[model samples]
Target: MTTPAQTPRSQDLDRIESELIAFLEGRTRASWDEDVDLFATGGLSSMFAMELVVHLEQTYGVSIRGGDLKLDNFRTVRTMADLVRKLTADKDTDG
Candidate 1:
């Protein structure tokens, strides 16, 4: 059973994972696990990261700038989901 706090997080993770998988469907052949390192595998390139950043920013309506723009944040599906959640939470708090 999920608590109220855990429910949103789980839903967010599921949504983010689905979106990431959809984006990567044709770009790579390998099936991606949430925690797997996207960079370590040949699944993504530096150039592709920019595209992903754009996708995330546009999709989530979150501005990922400054210190938030780190390669580590985009290293894997789970990390990317966490980054989105953080950015969204920050935006909610600020606005």
Candidate 2:
């Protein structure tokens, strides 16, 4: 369970999403469209993908593992936001 201090608000989610989008935009030469497929379009590589997971875990204070680390969860910025929300909610409930 998370203490009140550790809980992430909706703004935090938005911030994380913005940071991720900015990071992806800067790292890859391709222009980022929020609806574009990051992997299919060659915007993100396997190495960058792992880096994203690490960033999410650190920034959101959430642990992602097993099925949670699948490509579907990491496919898009919106999906990433949803994954973080689910993980954060699960942690808070468990805590």
Across residues 39-90, which tens digit of lDDT does each residue of candidate 1 receive?
A: 9987789999999999999999999999888989989998998999999999
**Whole-model Cα lDDT per candidate?**
0.87, 0.82
Candidate 2 TM-score, true structure as reference: 0.77
Off by over 4 Å in 1: 1-6
TM-score of each: 0.86, 0.77
Number of the top candidate by TM-score?
A: 1
Model 2 clashing residue pairs (backbone) = 1-95
- On the 0 to 100 scale, the lDDT of residue 90 in model 2 is 95
